[model samples]
Target: MSVLGSLTPLPAADHPELLAEPVVKALSRLPDASGVLVAEIDPDLADTAAFCEAYSSPPEFSANCVVVSGKRSGEVRYAACLVLATTRADVNGVVKRRLDVRKASFAPMDEAVELTGMEYGGITPLGLPEGWPLLIAPEVAAAEAVVVGSGIRGSKLAVPGAVLTALPGAEVVEDLARPA
Candidate 1:
């Protein structure tokens, strides 16, 4: 009788009080947030295609959020949220340029966890720390809906595509992502 019956368990939604502090704080800011979904899965898993297939979700529905560091300061900041299995965030171009950083690179696992308060494979744009830019690819926005991480390694959250764009501090950009 779960909201996502026979699919997966979303820890955040199931135990909202147990969520990481940053996630809790972020969710507090987004009162309209539809809520996050968690699924049970292996932590070592990295392939989005296989993950989607196992979850019975369309590959295109996955939103991949990539964290990048600042160019000059090399500070761990900014994140690009794009659709998985179809498009890759233009990290060096649109993402870097949009952040106004002279250089940018993928954020390390530890750093991603520290800043977002979520596990390496479970970070979602919905409950990210405040001020971290959440850039959405135009194509992702165009989609009718999307599936995002549920703040825990074992789940995913299905939400309206427009809802992703509506999150506080989210920026909808064109060509932010390209086919992988």
Candidate 2:
């Protein structure tokens, strides 16, 4: 794994305080979570661009998890998409068809935060609700190391992409993301 600038990444399992409750719980369930690492960061720089700049990690090396929702037959369905920071999830085209919904849009901030039990900018696919689909862009799923949320703004997690692919409901899709 390459150095993530000046940030110090330590074994995530040894420091539960750096992760949110949901993430910690999720990590416990993963048999291959040994490669996961965590590093402290300024909450104010949690957003992608600022984070990449501050931490000296390229956007392509970071995965941003976004929550999306759509309705079908009067029922609402939610899914999480983990795409590289350098790209954008193709919600209207590929994702809409994948979810079998008429259209898909980003979930409301409050709804996402409440349902995931994680901060708005810190939501991750690892601990999503039981049935939520986790759509991973191919690039993110194939990476050796990727920076992702630790389910909180004050810290970030460095995880092997294989661990993400091992998560429940994770699906790697072609054209899952388009250029940002």
lDDT for each of the candidates?
Answer: 0.67, 0.89
- lDDT tens digits by residue: candidate 2, 120-156: 8889877899988899998988998899998999988
Candidate 2 weakest ten by summed lDDT = 1-10
Task: Go through the candidates in order and give the clash count of each.
Answer: 7, 0
Pairs of residues at least 3 apart in sequence or in different chains that clash in candidate 1: 9-38, 10-38, 38-155, 39-154, 39-155, 40-154, 71-103
If candidate 2 were superposed on the true structure by all CA atoms, what would the RMSD be? 1.1
TM-score of each: 0.80, 0.97
Which has the greatest TM-score? Answer: 2
